[model samples]
Target: MNETLIRWLEEREIADVRSRNLELAKAFAMVVKSTDQVFDLGCGTMSNFRYLDPLLSMNQNWIGVDHDPGMLRRSEPLVPRTRVQLREMNLATGVRTLPQGPGCAFTASAFLDLVSKEWIDQFAAHCKDSPILIAMSTAGQPEWSPIHELDEPIRLRIKSHQNSDHGFGPSLGADAACYLVDQLRHYGCRVIVRETNWILDSRDGTLLSMMIDGIERRVQSVQDPVDAQVWADRRRLELLKAELRLTVRHLDLLSIP
Candidate 1:
């Protein structure tokens, strides 16, 4: 993942309260019969563990995987050393190394959007017997409380950027949640999906600002750079004045074999 994206993930971990499907997560926890071994893919800073650990009733052993050694090191203090294990693995080429089987669960947060179809297929093949819970995959829609004229164009450009390769090949991006649901069902796994959109307002200014910057960067790469900058400026001003609110659509999925 890009360094900018890692920063954004840090901000998101703090601001992303709505994106966690607690009820579904609790349901997943209830089904665990033995030691809960959760393998969190792209586990930047172990934020997913921070969120789910409190909600789960059973004893958990988390194996957090990421290619970034810095991220692994940073997350070390967040989780108890006895309960958590960290692995430095690039998931794009390391799916074969993922742990699987009963008592194990696969999880990722705000991560599926960055992966390719082939990567997901390989992941599914490896974890065929494990339950999976994936959260916060983008759903390609941005709803602004006070609508702007440039919103649609900027959204289109961002969507285009999302579909571009992010090291795993052309990414499934916004369509990742639905695609995974279908793929898991084909494997005879029971799957459930829920909307987990991010609702941001004045109280979430920092995250809102980071979101605007990310959108502007993506938009600039594929569309008129000037327009993108101008739109970002206007949005930043609105954010500064506490006059902006945003609902970024996302999806969460739970699958059990």
Candidate 2:
């Protein structure tokens, strides 16, 4: 997928995208602070740590797990081992049990969207004992971006196109948070739904390029060669023009069942 485009799109939409996550993290942190342990799953590069770190700044055992070795390496240096621990785990093949003993909170960001439906159910079950689950940017559909009215078609089409991408997992686009909310509630979780609509500005050029590139690649998978080339060229010009803003619809769910 075109990470540039995704990043660009996300940059414009960052405000709405992660606003709830920050809030959720703060709330979850309160619970984490009271517990002996905290967990961050699929801790890709520990980028999610930025959200949870403030809560962990004091003395709490922080553990982050991911299948990606590189992300673990990057995270190890950024987070203190005394306060934080890192592990490798294939999120698709989830853990029947969490690494640290059950605690007040388990946090994940953007990771939930990449997992399959089966994984989510399993996750809900595994995390049942934990007091709170904070999932940020559970990608969903019926995007709630402020500009959803304007880019609904494009966003919808792009999401559809990207579903065919190599790594497109079974995430419920833009609505994972909402779906999880329902599931957690079904599982007896008292879920708190907080949604954010972020306006991404041009600072995220690489992000935009990535999204467009990912889309272009998917479209090219079935499109004519010449047509694909033309679209590619057109996208190039659009990026060159700059000042293009995007709205990212992000949904976050906090559950304490």
lDDT per model, in order? 0.83, 0.59
| Model 2 regions more than 4 Å off | 1-20, 99-104, 138-157, 161-169, 222-229
Total clashes in model 2, counting residue pairs 3 or more apart in sequence or in different chains: 33
Question: Number of backbone collisions per candidate, in order?
Answer: 0, 33
List runs of model 1 lying over 4 Å from the truth: 1-6, 223-226
lDDT of model 2 at residue 202?
Answer: 54
Per-model TM-score, in order, reads 0.93, 0.76
- Model 1 lDDT per residue over 38-154, tens place: 889999898888887777764778899998998888888888889889999988898887667887888888899999999888887888688888888888678887888889887
Question: How many clashes would you count in candidate 1?
Answer: 0
lDDT of 1 at 117: 91
Model 1 whole-model lDDT (C-alpha atoms): 0.83
What digit string (tens of lDDT, one per residue) describes model 2 on residues 183-230?
778888777866654444456566556655655565555533223445
Candidate 2: Cα lDDT at 250: 65
